[model samples]
Target: MKIVRPFSFVLAIALFTPAIRAQDGVKKDDKANTAISYYKDVRPILQQHCQGCHQPAKAQGGYVMTDYPNLFKKTEKEVIGVVAGKPADSELVKQITAHDGKKPAMPRGKDPLTDRDVTIIKQWIEQGAKDDTPASAKLPTVDANHPPVYTQSPVINAIAYSRDGTLLAVAGYHEVLLHKADGTALVARLIGMSERIQSLAFSLDGQWLAVTGGNPGRFGEVQIWNVEKRTLKMSIPITFDTVYGASWSPDSKLIAFGCADNSLRAISAETGKQVLFQGGHGDWVLDTVFSVKGTHLVSVSRDRSMKLTEIATERLEDNITSITPGALKGGLQAVDRHPTKDELLIGGADGTPKLYQMFRTKDRKIGDDFNNIRNYGTMPGRIFAVKFNADGSRVVAGTSYDGKGEVRVYETTTGKLVSTAKGVNGPIYAVAHHPKESVVASAGFEGIVHLNDAVTGALVRDFVPVPVKGAKK
Candidate 1:
């Protein structure tokens, strides 16, 4: 020791100090790690990010993580779940951590996992991924008879009216609940599809109801059901796992829908054949509406632009943006055309509903208008659904960014705020106006469909299709 060099002394301290810290770090991580069990640490992460595609009911790629047993089972692709104590060897870890431009990542449409989240997952697996779930954490096996029960408000993704306007089809978990338009009785439940019903539309003739949705990241499908027969007519499988805006043609011969793959496609109602594919959206296309004349189709997208395409020619009619395009920000989420004019009512993340003249004369066009006629403000959330109230004089918009569900009715021509429905209690995803009356129906996160007088905004009827005896929804 008396002859030891300065370098030797420093090296000894470096090695010894790290060893002490390593021991301390392990102690700390383990203390935190003790709380990391399959039910506690891992399940919440999967439920938020992975369950949409991996749950038992959907089981995309035959990987079901709805329970502890399902979570640890090897995937259908023959991928190992967790090699004991070896996150580096586990296929689940590799897939989630993988970054390849040639292939899409896990949780296809949403954000990827964080580094800390990855560490927690690895630690859980390293600790044997024990099943420590409490009794209350267990969920019922989801099936036709045991469909997903809403403990909280269920988001209404789509809604439609029968051609005759006698029945309303409200989107439900693995089913479409058909209710009397007046909300007086339950007509029937059209059950099919895996989950996530995005859009529903009764065929123009009202003979068929076309539904668009799928287990995101696993499969995207369009299911057509015969209204009277209440049977599946066609199940058109799409290449992507998510689709939006199933729009029926004016003649109801073909159905056009937008896909996650940034393409607009059409399928023949009779043959189930893909007839047209137009790729132009720079991002996800959110909604599509057939022009009243059926000569063109208008689509809005996350790209912050609304486009018009001529159907027969499949050519671009115009690429329209908001009035304050450079300043205003948010994806356009909904679009509905005037019943008789070429004007469009659009809503988006910006929390305002705007009326735009799709085809304006030179005299009618404003200074650098970009088709925007006027925008209605004062709404507190992003507009998710908008429609011309059968007559085209009034425009209705449903909004969602905030927790409070809001529906606004405005004078289509004057952009005057006519009526507003408050106390929706959650986001309003789908809204429809009675074809022959002043009544309007709205449903969303609350699960209850609320019928209101379009003029007075008075709640006339509110009913839950699948009522939870003691639950809020």
Candidate 2:
């Protein structure tokens, strides 16, 4: 039987159809409005592409993206790196999006961000750029009670012996391990900082030890410790991830170091005041040394330049490599000045350690020009550490490449190879000579601190500072 539908039934069908369409629209809106989290969605992009150049320590172009607070704050140049809820108005967004030929995209020489990454960053800013990172997602918290656990091998970066030749200090994971000069006993563990220790120097009086280092890409600091009391005397946090090649003034009144930010800085030993600052290098400042008279400071950098700064006036006295023209062809990594003369030694990626005369003029008015003496080609790897013997008769260097390390000594007057030691099994970052003996100490990727007889090139002492954690003593 054919029956016609009721008017109320037909009207109800139409009403429910519109209601279902409205509910579907609500679901679509909810998916579009899913909140974008900074830690979850944005941080990975930044850490992968941005943190290398834009972080708290090396905030390139005055922008830092490592932390939420620094990212949202305006820089000293009055340009805000990121603006909450306004991605288009932010400097970071502009730089990232300026991939056109008119303006350079950031990461400078690296590849630009992917389209997906850019969209996520924009959405994060649109969502107010909140700091949704959990406490555990932050950098490893460091404190006195809970020392930072260095999971990797203690890749030693520096080693020094007291002026009296009694105590030897070797760089540790987060402290300085002071051992007897003979390496038979442990004297003290100098603990104060929470990062890798890169360089260490004992004052002329041997009463204080100056340490330079920090967490790479996080912070940089100089810590002075009283050797007698084993107490921290002073702490100076720098404007980079870490520092290298710390040198002491002749009078032991100040300490100078080359920072990762390409700046040279010095601080007073008596007071923590910054006594000198000379921003001269275009790349990472790898090494620095004070003149024998303490009147001038010399520094070498990965920029392939060496600079001299007057201590009194804090002025760039000269750029040595500029005059010599191609004297240094690669990144200069290590520098050492003569103890009592106006000569210096430098080594780097060129795989050759060369000597230079600081001043050659009779009246000494003409300065800052390199007078290259000789190139010692005894080592074929990157020289990470260089030093002159106490009498300035010989120079020793530590080098490493392709997982191999070596220590070489050469006569200063001639480039004759005097002695060589090999089979370190890893890269060696530091080497030091005894003030009164022919002893040499080298340490690096290998955990063992290797001491050698500089004259014979024989391994004398192999001091293992950190044994395998779970292994038996």
Candidate 3:
């Protein structure tokens, strides 16, 4: 076998071996060169960690990362956030990466980005940082001028009357409809980017409106609107899901709200900066209210507990509800503080409304709901909304059962059934009492705002809050 090899065969073997080795090297290079997309791989990282502070309304440090072009712009300190093809020279990379065993600087007060996320962002910048966002992924412009067009009325989840009793804010799709309290005319439309508005509140001074909502699985937002100017003052994006139960402090200096992440948070009204964070709830916090003095925050949760937290120290002070198992049959959904006292009116899955004193008047004992003041008669279904009248004389609760809805008014001290609003057609999610008049506005799945006489329970008038396309007014 060794004696009969041809010269051409030997030459061919040598050439083919080197060629195959070179081809293998090329395949490895191709795998390393795989593109990293800004939209698919990098944008989500920013949305989760950075956009909460760097969005348009809360552009901390003058860096806005919500849009692609804003990434390459100069910062307030004249530093470039991202430099194409040079991750080491990029300010964004420097801020997110650690040096001398210290944590990253950006995403201040939060945990640093995961190693994998950091690598993806660096890789995207190294690949020239191209924007690969598709047309469908782009957010539509929604604001005061370019308002949301509703083909049909959206399910109203919240409504509130201004402190002056002149304006009614109704939750709508991507907006809050401001109507005259009489329900005769639409006054203004406060449009924003959130798809669902969960809760609404007017500042005690009647100068500002606070709203909580978000895109269902994407983000949570807190919007502060200037009531008189009809302008969006600030938009603060927070958790991953919609937030609920926004309430303003008595001084209007801070706003507190419940989050889907089982946490309660408060922010500065002027700066949109998070000032207080409490994580005592075992389930999603459904509603929140400040104590009369604004020193304590009372939050009701789906965990069947109402926990109080001290705002100054950010510590859980007490569990106002009994913690004994089976004491609270279901989760709590709505909460409202008394107009003049420290009493709380709460309702939820149990369909019963119970008032609890905000502070403990006695020592705690096992299995004792010591703060329970009085129990109002139960409604026909799960209560989604509750409120006390101007003078704290009466309370209103809205409920939904099967396909029908009911709104009930009750005397606060005597616990007597005052009246039940008539002509409600669908599930009721929101109810609000007028500040100076004996009227209550109720709305829900049917999308019609009903003005009912608080004393008589008769429907005074009803109207769809949003303008329906091609439909007569």
Candidate 4:
């Protein structure tokens, strides 16, 4: 059994009450998708943080969450604990985060947990409710001598993990490489178009890679690769006058790019066909992404606006919400997803990066409301990229602040500061987390990949082998 926080007991007690769950998080403007996970991932985090007062013996506030079968025993509806895979449908998470200011997420006011823990809980609930099985919550950790192996890339920009967590995709310095997560053996290096690879993204099925960036002497192109055969699938010719971004559609059939042409273009992943080509931004399209709900698309442009379009028609939703000029516009640098939520994040154009909460509603409406139950934000450095940890509760933001090109973590809902990691002198260009652990491998302008301790915010290895107390070596 793990040590439980005290205040969380009070929260559980309050949360068990049928009435309290009903009044939990969700504002009129909140536009977040509901993802419910029950057993494997969800129950463990909840039991560890919330079971103190919610057990059958205590039955805090008349609520007993001892087991899934019994959770709805006395509850008015399945909405009491969670609806599995939908945060909006589950009142448990909302109550902990205190969506309506009724209660501040579990363990109350102080964040006794990290962002990773939050996301894992959310994902578990969203994935159809797994049991609090030891296997789901526990993992085989890497010992000092037995730690996983890997190779680093030059100017690495992005990374992706296979759904099974067996392989990882790395992009940087003109190539996209696939490697076994445990061995780091090079699987494939995307041939052709060798430039300082600026951005890389993997298709939903982990079948393809999308590469985008500009070089001083060469043109920029978005290349899609076949991971199994290690072959280039399609390349969208492009050039970023300054900066650019690349992403694959939810279905992984279309590739999109934010290019120097001030255009957002989507190309067929298979035939390399042009699916959609729309251009109208006053300046460059800084970043873009498909809404998780799969109903719309979004982009932030240097011209000072965040645009939302219905995905089915590639047309702006008739009443799309307006979030004029993100915090970083002309200097807009990067954008990242909420690992498990229907939210997207934006980075800055200058030295200081501010995180914004962008959420989409069930009806296809989007908004930037910090008070939203499903929407959350963070304050990071001159951010270039922000990606959700496997769970989506915690997000790592890549920074560009000189000497401060660090990766920072923050709680998604309360905006609570988590940790800051440092190692590079150049701008922090990209960051990605291991699918299961708190380890973060980052690449920067200085051309070095760093393996970092996500929880302690420490560099995984010592600079000169000086032994720190309790050092893993």
- Kindly report the root-mean-square deviation of model 4 from the true structure over all alpha carbons: 23.6
Q: What is the lDDT of residue 200 in candidate 1?
A: 91
> What is candidate 1's lDDT per residue for 385-422, written digit by digit as tens?
98888879998888886577798888877888888874
Whole-model Cα lDDT of every candidate shown, in order: 0.75, 0.77, 0.88, 0.57
Please, what are the lDDT tens digits per residue for candidate 2 over residues 126-182?
888889888875764343344446544577889998898988898887788889988
Comparing 1 and 2 by TM-score, which wins?
Answer: 2
- List, residue by residue over 94-186, the lDDT tens digit for candidate 3: 999999999999778777987767877888899899999999878765545468888898999999999999999999998899999999999
Off by over 4 Å in 2: 1-152, 322-327, 360-370
Model 3 lDDT, residue 250, Cα: 94
lDDT of 3: 0.88
- Model 4 misplaced stretches (Cα beyond 4 Å): 1-154, 180-185, 214-218, 239-243, 317-330, 350-381, 422-425, 461-473
Give the distance in Å from residue 359's predicted Cα in candidate 3 to where it truly belongs. 1.2
TM-score of each: 0.68, 0.69, 0.81, 0.57
Worst 10 residues of 1 by lDDT: 1-10
Instruction: Give every collision pair in model 3.
Output: none
